[model samples]
Target chain A: MQLADRIEKRRFVGRELLLWLWMESELFDGTLHTEEHGAFGFWLEKQLVLSAESESTSIKAAAPGLGREAKEALLRGQLPERFAVRISKDDEETSLVLTGDTLALRALKLATVLDKKEEAVIGDLVDELAGRTRGRKKKKAESEEDEETPFYERMSKAAEVEALLGTLYRDFLRLRLDARWDAVVVPTMRQWAAGEDVDADAYRAAKRGKSTKGAKGAKAAKGTRK
Target chain B: MSALSGSLSYSRFFVTLQGRDGTIRSAGSAADGSLPRGFLDRSYEKLLHHAMRPLDADEPESERSGWCVLGDPLDVSLPKERVYLEGFVNLGFRTDKWVIPGAMLRTRLRQAELAYREQVGREKLSRRERAELKEVVTRELRKKLVPSTRAVDLTWSLDEGLVRFFSHTASAMLSMVDLFEKTFGAKLVAESPYTLASRLRGEDDPIALDDEALWEALTPTILVPEGDA
Candidate 1:
């Protein structure tokens, strides 16, 4: 595919993914559990700007704290395209900005893990990657705990951030590609986003309870939770 | 540079090379450039030339803009599933006007003119003469003036062909992309609303990408009303 075409197509997925995050947060308290990636937390942090896809210029939601009405306006037809998100994994939290149209995540502020004992943990993590590449294993991760060097620590942290971002991306893809996502989850999320009373947990449980549509069984669809 | 200082923000993107099977090996290293040594060091130079720099008075007035790399990589993957590289993009601007404020310059010239007139017994200095004097004064003052610099950090995943740059300003993102592309020799595929459907559904079938109909079947997703598909 042409790079321009992919660039063009990726933003819609980004916007939808962001909408899913907002919906998941408001309804499920910003937490989602799955067998593949386990429980991950996502929350709106700092400044969050939402706009309608129709509006050429997306006005910031100035409806006060949390801006429920502004968020509702999104459900009426306007969908969230850009916002700041706080994603938590393994008890570590990071604040990042997510632009839905292009799916770009900028300014990720992960908890400072350098200079602390946590640095050793990052080293240990990179150590496990020693034998992945064949001839280039020697050129692998640059983390060195014994050195306590700034370069090594930074490398370790970057690796961790990439892994975290990848996990979140995959989790989003899972939700996005699910057969029921368009049919059931989106509609359910619209209600919750619009401030309508709906049992989000129950709805998720029902989703978890059933096999994916069209697919033969839980094993076939990879949708069942442990 | 620490090679790894600190960043409060970053812009994230995916990198996809042209023409490749889905196999993981194709994702490992860039088609060119090694990490840390060749890539990072060279990239540092590329960025500095683009960052803002202090303008000297003797130098003719022009648009003075440049950037630099702050610290080292928080991560580097030479030949692995992916290479994660992060650095701060340091930017600064030294305007002749800002460094040599008109008000300040005028006042200083007034003082110099008085001294010159008192010593030379002159009423008014010619434009060329005044300019020559101000030029010398501006040069002396500007030499001592320091240009203020600001920086934003970025993370790039070579194999995934994605980058996460930390800036919300559209103008900043554009420069980030330009410097990044120049430094890496690779184009960044940004995620936007219009492109979402194509990215996730871009591959109708890895084996059948050549089929024009397959590409047509994948419709890009746009923001529609809740009831609408």
Candidate 2:
């Protein structure tokens, strides 16, 4: 097959990725992990859209994925088309709407440390005004650094979030391309979608079973536990 | 969303630099500054060559698109200092389109046709004459109107080989990609499921199977079984 054909055909994988993410988020109680980022709070928020062919369902709520309608849509053969998600690591929290087919991130709100930095800058300025410290050259250099700090912080945080996403995608691919996908993931995913209670430990054990390739899948699955 | 301020929303694209041998490769690490020597200088020159041109009232072209200063679209003076940031090549994609209201055009055309007929002492005009009158009327109307302009911020992270285009609209992305390829001789593969997967798998992984074969054999998971559904 041509490259374009392969890309087009695999576009559905994006929807499946989102579906898998939603299932894992609920089963793991909004905590998902990767080898890189130990465990992060991952959950659907604000909106969730699922569609198949001529029909689509859009749910807007504090937790759209927890609703019965979303599950019903899944049963109707619809997959998540796009959804708003909130991810938190330590004190940092990020939110964005992720489009399934293109995996495009929209309205990405990265956690900002600007307020604290601005406060520190204001304190320094106050000290200078009170004649508590600083020379002209020193003050000039400090102010210049202040001006560039927030931008660098913002870019750095954005990069960190992108890296986190990259690792998550890698983990998903590891399971997706392995025999564990059909043997374990799909059944448990179906159970979760049907509102059936799933034993997280059993699911993890099955995911780490011999069906997976060697020790890599088992090690990654181990990381998923809190 | 603007890159410098306001909300942060963007479409990500991975840059693939093509060599003289027609082979494609992902951009090198930012830490090593792995771009070929003088590549930055060459790219800067190309950026200058393709800088945005404001629409002229007398020009016949209905639309035009090109690059400009990131935050200030009006400033097309892309001095190297303004174009290059710490580790990023930041710029804006500006498009200007002349939009003449259809009703106004029809009205002006009718008036022009009537005046022309009277001047020639003819009650009716031929098809060719009408077409010429319409063109003339459109040009006159265009001169009286301003082109609508839109600017979207785009930042290229030199080290990461990633371009964050602020807008998600298809037309805007198409124009930006076309202009970008022209400005820098590199193909941009937009971030998608397949591309991300392949990239994460390491393009140079020796043990990796052929991507085409692996991806081709894959099928979509059936979330709802036939009997179960």
Candidate 3:
């Protein structure tokens, strides 16, 4: 088979990964602490979009700050084709509009280090460029600075973004391709997604059909989706 | 540092490709680590030239607005590190417009009506004619006008299968993909679940991936609230 065709057959994996991520976030308080991915935080932000893989087109729903509607969409048996998600590992944070099939980061918000690193570079470059433009007069005592960071800052930040994306995506792949992933991880996630006890089948059975028993009180807490 | 101050660096995509010798490399080098000179490649320009058509259907190629690689790769990083590209593309489209102010246009129409006296006068133009005139005027004006210019920012990580482009519009994305394919003589598939999955599986696990039941099982079953179900 042609390489494109071979890959196209598996394009749904991206979507499924995204769907899995959304489910993970919704079920696990957006805290994913696998040995591989570390204690990463993921949250579906202001928007949530779901589409059937079989569907030819895509549409998005704006997830409310309170995630009742988004949860309801999950109850609707649909999966996301594209959605904006916030991912963080402690102080570092990135927001991305990740598409399912192509695993494209259609829109990306780089990690916070983006600005810190960028500003540092820009400041240094600007100082050097400024020095060159004005014949290298040494002036270390300037309190004020140009309000705009030079455009060149994007190059360095782009490198950082790519690196971080690679790391995160690899983490995801590690999680997905693990031998235990399909058999163990997903079923537990499925239970978690429904706000059920992973161990207690009876509790899940009873929780079905309008029985607000175990953690209706903690629903908002477990899934702090907004 | 602050959320409000945060701005995106660029849109990131995954590029996967296979060579003729059955070697599939997501990120391939030109052997010497140079950004594609494909902007100057005749095929790239020709493809873009046709895409940006003349403002009018009958207008010739000379009148068309199109894309050009403004210059060399905007920036090239080390011996084999990275390449940044800034592309220039022209946009041309016919517009029906009136340069005259609305009040003036109305006044002119009223005056032309008065000039008619009885039936329509020589100065009086019908709505159809006025629209036709507008098209002709706009077309002529368009010739004098330069096509709008936009700067596309792109960075290709030579070693990583990543391309970060600032523009996310469909047109820009398609253009970048086309440009990359032409430049590298390889296809760039935006790394997605499927492509990534296939790559991760490697060439050895063909049987596991190809199993129809395994593929079917991989499909998601939406576990929704039974109430909705």
Ordered from best to worst TM-score, the candidate numbers read 2, 1, 3
User: lDDT tens string, model 1, A82-172?
Assistant: 6776667786766666676655555544455323334545555567677433323332332332234454454456556655545555555
Alpha-carbon deviation at A35 in model 1, angstroms: 4.3
Q: Model 3, range A18-64, lDDT digits (tens) per residue?
A: 76666656556676544335677777776667655453333344543
lDDT score, residue A100, model 3?
68
Among the numbered candidates, top DockQ falls to 2
Model 2 segments more than 4 A misplaced: A113-149, A210-226, B29-33, B202-210
Query: Model 3: per-residue lDDT, tens digit, B13-95?
Result: 65555645776555533343333355235444444433322244235222322322221221211111112234312111111
Q: Which docking class does model 1 fall in?
A: incorrect
Of models 2 and 3, which has the larger lDDT?
Answer: 2
Candidate number with the higher TM-score (1 or 3): 1
Candidate 1 lDDT, B72-106, residue by residue in tens: 22122122222223432222211223356778878
Candidate 1: misplaced stretches above 4 Å?
A1-10, A45-47, A53-67, A113-162, A174-179, A197-226, B1-7, B13-54, B61-69, B72-144, B151-173, B176-184, B188-229
On a 0 to 100 scale, what is the lDDT of residue A14 in model 3?
A: 68
Q: Is model 3 an incorrect, acceptable, medium or high docking prediction?
A: incorrect
* Residue B224 in candidate 1, Cα distance off native in Å: 7.9
Considering only N, C-alpha and C atoms within 3 Å, which residue pairs clash in candidate 2? none
Q: Best by TM-score, which number?
A: 2
Which model is ahead, 1 or 3, in terms of DockQ?
3
